[model samples]
Target chain A: MNSSHLSLGDSEIRIRMLSQVYSASYLTRKKEREEKSKLLEQLYVHDVYDRIASDFEEQQYQPWPKVKDFLLGLESGSLVADVGCGNGHYLNVNPNISVIGVDRSFNLLRAAESRVPGVNCRADCVALPFRDNQFDAVLFIGVMHHLVSSERQVKALLELSRILRPGGTILLYTWAYEQQKRKFNGQDLLVPRYPSVGEDNPHCNCHRPTTKSSGDQLLTLPNQSQLSVLDKLERIFVRPFNLFINLFKLNSHGDSIETGESKDYINSVPSTQSDTLDDKSINLITKCSNSIYSNTLSHSDYHYDSMILVPKEFRVREFPASSLFSVSKVLNGKVSVHKRDCVSHSTNPARSRDDRFYHVFKRGELENLIKSSKSNLVVSKCYYTSGYWCATITKNTL
Target chain B: MKILTHNMLTSNIIKSVKDGYPLKIAATEVQEVDVDFNPEFIQRLLAKLNWSVICEAITQLDATKDIELPENLTDEVKEDEDMLRKIHHVLLEVEVIEGKLICPETGREFPINKGIPNMLLNDEEV
Candidate 1:
C-alpha cells in the first residue's frame, strides 16, 4: 500500500515524527509552549524555508504541490482567510493571494506578520469579527481541532457557517482516524495512525500487516506504541479554575465579555492580558484543562474533537461532524511518511514528544505579555510542518 | 537591517538548526539598502532565499515588477552574472538607513544609525 513517491531520505523522517508529538502534546500546558512557539519562529527564518524552498524551488517556493494556476486565482483580490495560520505558512506561501490569517496563539501571529507582508487579523473562530458572508472564499487549511470540547467544536463550526456567504467555498485539512487498531513492533499500544482503510474507505487499500489485541484486531507498529499514553494530571486540584475560563471569553467578539481589546487584552497600561481577571476564574479553567490534557487520553482530550465548516444556511447530515473534520477534510494533503520511517529504524526512537518544539500555548499565556503591549502582534496557527509548534502572532496596527 | 532578517539568525541556527548548510547571517547592521539588482547574484540568491519571502521583501521594497518569480530555477532566473550582481546589490548592498531592528520576540527596538546597528541590550531588553 506504500506509494513509490513515499520514500523519505533520512533527516525528513526525524522532523516528521518530531512534528507529530509536538502538535499532539505541546499546547496542553504553558511553560514549554512558549519556548516552542518562539523556536518555530526561528526555524522558518533560518532552517526550514531554505531547505523546503529547494524542494519547491522549481515550484516557486510554495510548499503545496500543484499550486501555480490555482493560486493565481487569489490575485484577483478574492478575500481569503488562513484559519489557524501558524506563522502564516500558507498565507505567506503564495504572496499573490488576497488573504487574512487568524489564530488563538499570539506569539506566532507576531512572527508570521513579520515574515509575511500584508496579512490582516481578526479575533476568533468561536465568534468572528466580520459581517455575514463577507469573504469570497475561506481557507481552514491545516487548523481546527485544537478546541478541546465538543461544544467548542460545534461552536466553531456554527460560527464558520454563519460567516460564509452563499456560494462561498471553504477548504480545510487535518488528521484522519484509522479503524484497524495497531500496535508497534508486537507491543500492545499504537503510536500514531492514518485512517485505516475501513470497510467504507474509498481511497486507501486495506493492506497493512496487523495483529490481534485483547480479542480486538490491531495493526502492528514497527517498534513502539503509536498513540501516546499521557501523564495523569490532578484535576481536582485544577477544577475551580476551569470554570472561570469558560465563563470569561478573552476572544472578545462573543458578546458582552471584554473585547480583549483596549487596556485589557495586554494593553500594558492599567491591565495586562492575564490580569483582566476581575474574577480569578480564567486561570482556574486554564489550569484544569491543562491538567486534563496532561493527563491520560480520553474523550475530553483535544485530539478527539472535530472541526468542520457548513454554510450558515445549511444543515449537515449523515457524517458525525467530528469524524468529518478529522478524517475527511483535515487529512486532504499529501502525507510524507518520511519521519515515521525514521523512527522505525532509529538507534533510539521515541513516539511521544522527543521535545516540546511542536507545541502551541493556551489563550492565557498568550495574553500575559500582550495586554497593554502594542508591538504589532497577531496570532494564527501555521500549516503543519516542522517538529515544532507554529504560530502567526503579528500586530494588526503595525 | 529589517527585523525579519534578524529573526532567522541565531549563532546556533546555522550550525544546529539545520546542518552547516547555509551560513546564518547574524548581522549587527544588515541595512536593507535600495540597490539595483546584480542580475547574477539575484540568480544565485534565488537558490538561497525562500522565494516567497524574497518576493515578499521585494514587494515591500518594490511592487512595480509583475509578481513573477522563477517557477523552476532552470526555467526561471538564469545564472547570469548581471542578475546575481543585481540581487547582490538589492539584498546585501541595500541600506535600511531610517528604521530600527526590534527583538523578534519582545518588539524592543535597537536603533541603526549611519549604517551601524545597535543590538546592545538595556536592562529592559535583556
Candidate 2:
C-alpha cells in the first residue's frame, strides 16, 4: 500500500464524517427554526389579536364599500363564510345571507359571537373545519397577509377552495405594499396594533382607517429620510455593535440572525395618490402620542418560557450607510416616530409586541399565488382598493 | 355553535384522518336562541348539507325538546313550511353552548366553549 494513497483515503473518511456532523447540525437548525416560526406565529398573530379584541371592536371598522357591495350583490339565503371575521364586522353586513365567521383568536370570536351570535368559531384559516364544497361564497377579507409564508398562504387559499362550492365566489383582501401612510421595507413587516393606546386615549376617538374619505388614520411609520445627523451618527456607531451581536450569535448558535436582502419593490411601485399628509392622521397622531410608548412593550417584556426567534423573512433590512446619509432632514416634532428595524438591536426595543406580522403583497403577487396553487379557481376580478389588494376568485363549476 | 354550523364542520384537518365528516357531538350545555325563521334559507342549506349528518348531530345533542327532522329530506319537505320550520329551529335556533366535537374516524375531541367549536390543531396534532 502506498503511504500517499493511505493518507488520501484517511482524509476522504474524515471529510465524510465531517459532512455527517454538518448535516446533523443542519437538521437540528431547521427543526429549531420551525419551532421558532410556530411560536412567533402564535405570539404575534394569534395572541396579539386576542389581547386587542375589544379595542379592535371599538375601532368600528365599517365594511369597505367594495366588500359591502359584493355582499349586497349575493343572492338571498347565500351561505357565506367570513374567514377572519374580527368582531364580525362583515358577518351581518347583509341580513339576507346566512354568514358564519371564523377566526383563530377566541377573544375576537367571542366578540363576534356577541354581535353575530353563534356564527363565529375559533379555527385556523389554513385548516378550516368546514366540509368540502359547502358554501355559495367565502369572504377571506384582510386575513391572508397574517400568514408568514407563501406556502402557508397557498395552503389557506387551497383550504378556502376546498370548502367553496362549484361556482362559489371568494372575496379576498390583503395589505398592499404600495400604501400611502405606512412604508414597508419588504413584503414581510410588522404593523403595530395599539390596543391599550386606544383605550387609554378614549378622548382621541381614533377610528379604524377605512376606504371612506372620513376615515381616520393613526400611526404613521417613521420616515427614514427624516433622521437627524445625531441619529445617523448613532446608527453608524450602532452598526458595529449590531455586527458584534450577530458575530456572538454566530459563535454561540452556529447561525446568524441578521437579514441581508432589502430591495425588490419598495420604490418600483407607483403611488396612485399623491403623498399629501391627511389631517385626520395628523390629529390622531397628536392626541395619542403620549400613551403610545407606555402601551407598546417589547417582546422580551412578555417573558415566554421558550426561546423566541423572529423569522428571518419577518425581519426588516438594516438601514444601509448610503441611504442613512442621503436622507433629507425634514423633522416634524408633532408626529411620533418608531424604528422599522425593531428586531435587530437590543438597545432599541421600541417595537410593540402588539405589532402583528404582515406580509404585504406586491401588485400581482396575490394573483400569482392563486394561479400557482393550480387549484380550480380563476381570478374573476382583482384591484387595489384603500391600501389593499382585493380580488374576487371563482371556483370552476365544470 | 348552531347545528347548522356543525353540519359543515369536519375533523379532516387532522393529518391521520382521511375523512372526518359528520363529527359526533356531546353536548354539556345547549341553548335555543330565537332567530327569524326563513323557509328559503332552510331550503338553500338543505341543498348543500347532508340530511343524514344533520339528523345524526341533532340526535347527538340529547335535547329533551322533541325536535325531529324528517328521516330523509324530500322535495315535499322543502315545500312544507312545518317541516322546514323544524329544520330551521334545529339548524339556526338550537345552540350547543358547551360541548365536544368527537372526530368520527380518530375519536379526537375538539372542545366547544362559549358556543364556539375550536377546530384549530396544535403543531403536533397536525
Q: Best candidate per TM-score, number? A: 2
Stretches of candidate 1 exceeding 4 Å from the true structure: A1-62, A66-70, A93-96, A118-122, A179-231, A234-398, B1-126
Model 2 misplacement above 4 A: A1-33, A195-351
Candidate 2 local lDDT, residue B120: 87
Q: Give the alpha-carbon lDDT of every model.
A: 0.33, 0.65
How do the residues B1-126 of candidate 2 rate in per-residue lDDT, one tens digit apiece?
A: 888788788898999988898898998999878898878877876887779888878777767246777787889889998888888888888888998999999999999999999898988777
Give each model a TM-score: 0.31, 0.70
Error of 2 at B35 (Å): 0.8
Q: Write one digit per residue (lDDT tens) for candidate 2, span A1-398.
A: 34455455596766666556655654565465346455557865888878777776666455666688999999887889999887787888887788999998899899889887777788888888888888999998878877765556767899999999999999997876555454333445545444334333222222232222311222333333324532653354334323211111122221110111122112222225444233344234323431332221111111111232222222223322122121111223343433433223223333344556666665556665676566898888766555677788999997
For model 1, residues A1-398, the per-residue Cα lDDT tens digits are 33454456665655666556544443343324223323333332223222222222122222333122344554343555555565555654544334566554444554455555324342345545334444545655333433332334344554454455555545533321212121111101222222222333222111111111221222222333212212111122123213212211122221111223223333222122231332234334334333432322222222111231111121211111111011211123432233533444344433222211111222322332222122223333222211111222332321
Cα lDDT of model 1 by residue, B13-124, tens digit: 1112222111122223333444344354244334433444444344443321344444444633465555445445544444443344333333444454433233323222
